[model samples]
Target: MSVDVEGKSLVDLLDMLEPAPVPEPISMVPQTWGWSVLALILAGLIILGVYAFLRHRQFNAYRREALIELAASDNNAAKVAEILRRTALVAYPRRKVAALHGKEWTNFLNQTSDNVTFTDGAGRQLVEAPYRDVKADPDLEILARNWIKSHKRERTA
Candidate 1:
C-alpha cells in the first residue's frame, strides 16, 4: 500500500466547505382505506341482488307451467293440486301453499277457491283431490293438453 504523508493531504480538504444533503424518509406502512372500499362493494352487491329479484319476480312461473303439464297429461287430482299449489305460490307467495302440511293443506284448498274441492280444508293435501274426484275439470284439462301439444310442436320444429 502507498502511504500518504501529512504534507500531501492539505490540498483536497481546503476546497470543500458545503454540508452534505439529507434524503427524505419514504413511508412503507400498510393501507387503511380498505374498509370503506369493501363496504361500497357490499352495497353494490346488494343492489345487484335486488335488481335481479325485481327482474325475475315470480321464481316458480316455469315450475307451475311444468306442473300444469303433468296434471294435464296424467289427469290426476294429486297432480292438479300440486300444480295449483305452485300457482298459488306464484300468485300469493306470502301465503305459500308449499309450507302447508297435514290438515292445513286441506283447509287452504277449500278456502282458496271453490274451483278446488279438498277432502280436508286446513291440511289441504296435494294429491287426494284427483284420486277422489273421479271427475276432473275437463275444461282445464283440455286447455293444458293443448298447451302441452303446442309446446311440444314448437320444441320439435
Candidate 2:
C-alpha cells in the first residue's frame, strides 16, 4: 500500500463542514403598522404619568407653603379668616370685601365671622373695610385678626 505524502489523512478533509450563512434582519416598520400603535400607547401612558406626578407635587407644595406661613405667623385665627375670605373671592369674583357694601358685604362677612351681631342698616358695611375704615369698627377688626390665628386649617397638620 502507498502512504500519504504530506501528513493529514483523507478522513480529516471530509470531516469539516461549511459554516452556515447569517440571515439578514427583516424590517418590521415597512411590513407592519402594529409598532406605531404600540408606540402611541406608550406615549399616552407616559403623558398621563407625568401629569399625575405634577398635580400631586403642586398640591403637596401648596400644603407645605401654608404650613410654613402658619408656623411663622403669630396670629393663627386671623390667618384662617383671611384664607376663608380668599376662598370667597375665588367663589365670587365680581364683588370683593372692599368693593361690596351694605347688606351684601355683611352677609359675606357673616359667613366667616359667626360671633359678631349685625343690624339691617350699616352694621355689616361698617366692618367691611380691609384697612380700617371710619365706619368699620376697630375692635371688630382686632377680633377678626385674633381669629385668624385660631381658624387656620392645614392638611398636613
Which residue ranges in model 1 land beyond 4 Å of their true spot? 1-71, 114-116, 120-157
Query: Who wins the lDDT comparison?
Result: 1
Q: Tens digit of lDDT per residue, candidate 2, span 1-157?
A: 5544466667765555457898998766745578788889999999999999998776445344544554453443344334435543533444345476556655655555556444444344343434442433444444443333233323332
Residue-by-residue lDDT tens digits, candidate 1, 109-132: 455543434453312334455456
Judged by lDDT against the true structure, how good is candidate 2? 0.50
After the best TM-score superposition of candidate 1, give how far the Cα of residue 103 lies from its true spot, in angstroms: 2.2
lDDT of 1 at 126: 41
Among all windows of 10 consecutive residues in model 1, the one with the lowest summed lDDT is: 148-157
Clashes of 1: 18
Candidate closest to the true structure, highest TM-score: 2
